[model samples]
Target: MSDERRSLHTENVELQRRLEGLTPLLAEKETKLIKLEQEIEILNNKLKQQIKEIENLKINLEEKLKENLKQKSEGERIEQRFKLNIETLNNELEEREFFEKVFLKIISILKSPELTETKIKSEQREASYRREEHERYQRVIDELNEQLQQTNERFERLERERNELEIKIDELRQKNDILEMELELAHDKMSQQQETSRTLEEKQRELHLQEKEHRSAQVRAQRELEALQSLSQSLANENKGLREERADLEERIGELTEMLNIRENRVKRAAELINEFLERYRLTSGRLKQQIGRQAEDCEEFDRLIQKLRQMPIPKPGLVQNLRICGRPGVPRLEK
Candidate 1:
């Protein structure tokens, strides 16, 4: 009985030792799980921040698009105004050309002696008729002068309005330039955010893989722990089984360690892949920046052309002369 008590006491000591060893392994696994959870939480926070930044970028892009649309509409309105002004100027030119032609026709009629002589009789009769015709011509000249004055006033008014419109156009151009700069800044920020998001995605994928590995390790560890518990229960009932089961548990632990090493190697390989991807991304970004620079240059050239068009001088009205006619001795003479 004493020998049996000593054997039982020894078995209890062995079980206690085994339990103590398992306690540390369980504690280490718990620490790893807690650390993984913390890492996952941190990644989640980072992802949330990235999502928020992306949303903000989207909002800014939408606003920029709206501003661009507004500017386009304003430009169209300005173009329409310019067209209308041009049409008004053309109509005024046509009216002036018509008046010039009419004046020339009147001068031709006065210069024709055959037409005047046919209408006139003797010199005394011609003189009285010529004086009456001169009064009528003077009245027509006064009327034409009044019309010319009104036309000049209208032209001056149009010129003033055109100057005002040009000032507005200049202001609009300044605003457009400001908007363009803002858009460039926004685009740069968006590019930066995209790069950050890509980095985050790679990190998230890595974390996911790590988490999956950890869960697998945890499941393997749990199974091993269950086996250890069963073996411990069997060893409590049968002393001969303890050594063999312990050896098996030690071998399983070694295998788990090897798997851990393999997992770590896989993580290193994933990191290398991430580095390669980043290198490719950097090359692509450089090319994109170069293309953006070329596009900016083209846009600047287009703006310059638009500015040149805006600065183009408007055609002014030409001066018109009063009609004068000189006739033969038998005919009447008219002067302006």
Candidate 2:
């Protein structure tokens, strides 16, 4: 039971360590989740800003197109006025022929390849500027799309990681609950162990007391055995005197009957003493009871009879010579 308790304690300590270890990991996961959410928020703001910039770019492009259309209309008006001036020059040339060379010079200057090339270059520059503007806007849109895609990917990854972290958190919570239950079980086991220990202690005390009592009974049985053996020896010695009175034994039959009655009374008293001992104490020793029973069977009545015989008048010397008391002569604590 103690070993089991130690193992329980060790497991509890290990679980506590695991719990402590997981606490920091859980906190770190939560921090990462928070950071991911913040990053997502930042990306959303950036996207909004990019969308606003696109709106501004569209507005600017519309204004630029309107300005270009106005410039185109003004150019058309100038070209028409130049054509009317050319018609007036042609009429004057036909009428006078004097200004024809100056008019031709003006027309040649107006029709010069350098001027046409310069006009084409200016139109190409305008077209190139518009193309560059469109390309610039397209590049910005592409960049924003790329950034959005990247943000989406990051969001997906963060969401997956967050799901994993949540699962880990749930598992940790379950483990914590299981550990707490195990701790409760361990506490209950410890309580049961304490109870068992107390019960065992009580049993040990009871056994100790029983053993002490058994030892005491054994001592008493030994003393009784010794007393019975001594009494048997005394009776054996008295048997010789009794035999010596063989000639008078027939005449003393009545007296012998009285002595037999006394012996019977002694037997009854010894039985009563054995019953008293049994009734007064718990006797669990089989060997002690057996030894006592054997000794009682041997001389149950004689030892007690010897005790009372000392108080009686001595038999006549001729018939009962050498009759004597035993074992300190006069102690009367004969429990038979």
Candidate 3:
């Protein structure tokens, strides 16, 4: 019985030692569970912060997109307005040309008489002069045509530039669309989060930076649009002034042409008067020649008559008695 009791006591002691070892192991497991829970909480907080940051980024992106769209619209409106003004200027130029052509025709007709006296030697010379005048007129027409062509080309180029700008705007719109989709997904993810930090201060800082950049971009775009508008306005004013100057030059040219025509006509009339005077002098010279011939004949007859009178003898008393005796005595001289 004693041996049995001793064996039972030794087994009891061994069991107590094993129980004590198990107690420390259980305590360690509990500690690990608590640590794991704390780690999970930390990870959850970090995930919430990331989601909030993503949401804020999305908002900034949307605002920037809207700003860009607004800028693009304004630019388009300005471009359209500029194009309309250019068209108006072109129309004015066309009208001015029409009036100038009519004035030139009138001047040409008024000056035709001056050209009539030119000694065009042959049909070829006449044709050549006509051709030269025609070529000069053609040159003026060609220059006007060239100006019109250049204007048209400029208009076309501007239109193409506008098209390119539109295309760029479309591309920006597409990018914004994609960014919006991404932003939507991020918002959905944030909504699913179980917990989130109230003060997204770090995210707000990022958003503020983005907002600042977007605003700066907007200001730049606005300035560019304003500059373009100013350029268009200045161009329109310059074009109008140029048109006025052109009109004035045309008027001056027309007046000078008319004056030249008047001078040419006066010169032609003076030449005709001179020719008439020359003919009158020639007729007077012919009459003087006939009178000189008649006077020469009269002088010859007077000289012969004077010579016959001188040859006749001087009448004396004896001469008279001899002449009477020579005549027959029956002459009735008995009264003597």
Candidate 4:
């Protein structure tokens, strides 16, 4: 039983380790999705500002064109640059959309509970098997206990029989003593009746026969006493052996009880841990879905900005170039 318990403990530890191992990967995926969402938001805001500036430039360009055609060259050059910027923003938007789709796929995969369910089911099956085995051992112990009780009862019966035999032997010995006294009295009477010599001889012969009968009875009583003593000793040894067997069975039952408790506790703890992890996964998945929606909104805002840019006119190169400078310090170069 102790061996069974140790095996169960080992199995529990292994299962817990397997479940814990999945957490880090889930966390990593969530972190990456959040970072991507943040980047998309920043890009969207920048594109919006650029589109607004293009609209303002277009408004100024029309007024400037009617006043002075000499500025046409500068206006054409600024319009070309603005188109290039719009193309770059469009490319960035396309990349962000692709990444957003990939992020959704990752979230969907993470939300799946198939693997966790399988693991939990497997653990439950193993626990059930152990419980069955424990019950089997318990039954065996019960049977051994009953056998021990029966053995004890038999020993008690044997002791009673031996006591009865001893009493009978004592009675037999007293009868032998009484018969010997009678034989002695008969011999003296034979000696006194000496007038008829032949009659006296016949009486002496009868007294000798009675002595022989008494001796035989003594011998039979002694043999019965010896047999009873031997039987009693054998019964005592058997009782001692039964007691030892009972003790061993009791110890085994104790070990099995301890084992069962340990297994029950382990299963409970594992269940709790799995629940916690599952709850955390649900929360993270919810946040990821929200972020995905936010990203989609940001994409739509960028789309609106692109349309505004297409409707706009040109701007002075110097003014637009200065405005296009990075608003945030240490921001990385905007990729096409």
For model 4, residues 184-271, the per-residue Cα lDDT tens digits are 5544544443334444445546545653553454345334434533543454354345446555334433443343334334434433
| Model 2 lDDT tens row, 44-154 | 555555555555555555555555455455545645554554555445435534444554466566876768777566557755765675566556556655655565565
Residue pairs in candidate 4 whose N, alpha carbon or C atoms collide under 3 angstroms: none
Score every model by TM-score. 0.33, 0.41, 0.31, 0.25
Most accurate candidate by lDDT: 2
The ten-residue window of minimal lDDT in model 4 covers 327-336
Please state the error at residue 39 of candidate 1 in Å. 33
**Superior by lDDT: candidate 1 or candidate 2:** 2
All candidates in order of lDDT, best leading: 2, 1, 3, 4
Error of 2 at 25 (Å): 48
lDDT of 1 by residue, 36-126 (tens): 5555565555555555555555565566556555655655665566556556655755765676567557656775676565434443464
**lDDT (10s digit) by residue, model 3, range 86-120:** 56655655665665566556555655555544422
Better of 1 and 4 by TM-score: 1
Q: Distance (Å) between predicted and true CA of 257, model 3?
A: 99
Which scores better on TM-score, 1 or 3?
1
Q: How does residue 272 of candidate 2 score in lDDT?
A: 54
lDDT for model 1: 0.47
- Cα-based lDDT for every prediction: 0.47, 0.50, 0.46, 0.45
Off by over 4 Å in 3: 1-8, 106-336
RMSD values for the candidates in order, in angstroms, are 49.6, 23.2, 76.3, 76.1
Off by over 4 Å in 2: 1-114, 129-133, 240-294, 301-336
